[model samples]
Target chain A: MLARPAAEKGLNNYMNDMFAFDETDRKIVEQLRRNGRATNQQIAESLNLIASTVSTRIRRMEEAGMLRVVAVSDFAVHGYHILIHLAVQVSGRPALEVAEDLAVFPEVFAAHLVTGSYEISLLLTLRDIDELPPLITGTFAKVPGIKSMTPAVGLDIVRYALDTGPVDSRSAA
Target chain B: MSRPELDDLDRQLIGILAQDARVSNRKIASDLGVNEGTVRGRIKRLQQEKLIAFTALTGMKLEKAANIAFMAIQADTAHVRRIARDIADIPLVKAVMIMLGPFNVMATCLYHDLDDLHRLASGRILEVEGVTHVETSLVVKTVKISNRVVRITDADTLSQG
Candidate 1:
């Protein structure tokens, strides 16, 4: 328990120090979030900065593993119809192990080793609502050390954004 | 909803753009054995169809020393949708969904630390009118996070393979 948080803090400290992701980077990212195709000249013009600085910062952030501009596909518009959240209780095995094992499945979108009543939390995408039954009973039942699973099928997804925050002093809590 | 299938060239273009959305269309066109106009036109059509979006997705843990959490909520059955929307509007919440099963509503949120997560669950989410029970879980480790909802048609499926 003590070791993980300490390791996390140390790693985060290194990351924060390794890259100075400041106000300018945030502004730059905001612009890109709005339009990823925006030219460096355009971003520089909008932000009132030198085009070289815009280019330099973007290159720096991307190289340092601090940013990624990805082309994301829509979920519902394609064939995937159902999304479910599952709170899993584990016994006899480390939660991370199970979480990692579960991660390989294409349907498991996000798997987390968690702290609470349940040991692991999962987000799943499915072809149809009916997939839930066979998945829970037939598939998940086969995985070792899964004591029980409490699942909630998403009837309507109000929001599905994952790139949450680079929360700092200005945006903390 | 019926939609046109993405051809091999289309998927290949998308794959390159997926890696670097900022890549020049001219660069992509040359690599794909097509003209810059063709590349631009396809990207425009894909965007207009709402099939793809270009955005900067942040690495939260590295970016802000933030953590992720999920809140499972029990809400008034009649007003579940309303309550879910309310939770969605709150800060820190990345996603919210009205659900069916043991809990009626679920949310995924990011926090600077456990305190922020605790505050979000008890202070923000619970205070919503229709919420009854709110069970919060803090993510200790993130195994995977993805949103690969791409559709593969039979044409590209065989050709690409």
Candidate 2:
């Protein structure tokens, strides 16, 4: 209880110290977010910065681990028809251990050790609804932990993003 | 939705781009021991197919010093879809997933500070119409977050291996 908030604060401090981004960096990131394959010249033209500057800023930000330009694939288009959120309540075993174990499965898109009713929460992409039972009974059986699990099948994903912010703060930048 | 399968070359290109989206076509082609024309052509085809998208993904935790909250909402079933969209429009809500289970709506929200999260929960999220129950779980740590399959198991098997 005491440790979690403390850790959050420590994270804030670390981010402030090492990960702070200026206006230019934020704008570059925004442009890239719109189009990851955007060339430096294009970004510079759009942002009214020099091409060299854009490239330099990108390199700096990448080194700082503040941003990543990646290819995002749509699971639904590829026949992964079902996406489920699982909240697992752990009894005796550690929650992080369980999360790490579940992380190995290819279906798991994201896993988190959370603070609330459930210990470990997961976002899984499955081929079909039929895969659910075997995945839990067979795959999860290998993971040693005794507790309850709740599965929520996603009907419509209204909004899902791998990275959520900088909050359209190009004005500030 | 019928789509063309990604061959070995396509998967290799995607895997490489996933690591560094800004890598040049020439560089990638050289690394993969393929011609630049083939690499360039495949990337264009991949984009046209909408199988993959190159975008900027910020590490919110590191960039904003933010705390992400996972909120589960119990809402009236009749207006579930509308309610989910409304909540998604609210500031700081990154994801709003309409679900079938105990909770009808779920969202992953980001807050710059704890006060923002408090205001969101007590001030806005709870006040939304038809929202009967709002359960939030603060993400203490993110163990894994990947948008696509980091490892392509069997290109032939749609199961993602």
Output the number of the lDDT-best candidate.
2
Put down candidate 2 lDDT per residue, A47-151, tens digits, no spaces.
888887887667656655566677766564356778899999988898888899999897787898899988998998887788888998999888987398898
Q: What's the lDDT for residue A140 in model 1?
A: 78
Task: List iRMS (one decimal) for every candidate.
Answer: 9.3, 8.9
Report the C-alpha displacement of residue A104, candidate 2, in angstroms.
2.1
DockQ of each: 0.38, 0.39
> Could you tell me every candidate's TM-score relative to the true structure?
0.82, 0.79
Q: Name the runs in model 2 displaced over 4 angstroms.
A: A1-19, A164-173, B1-9, B26-45, B148-161
Candidate 1 Cα outliers beyond 4 Å, as residue runs: A1-17, A129-134, A164-173, B1-7, B147-161
User: Across residues B14-72, which tens digit of lDDT does each residue of candidate 2 receive?
Assistant: 77886777899999999999999999999998777666667775656444636778999
| Residue pairs of candidate 2 with colliding backbone atoms | A23-A173
On the 0 to 100 scale, the lDDT of residue A92 in model 2 is 80
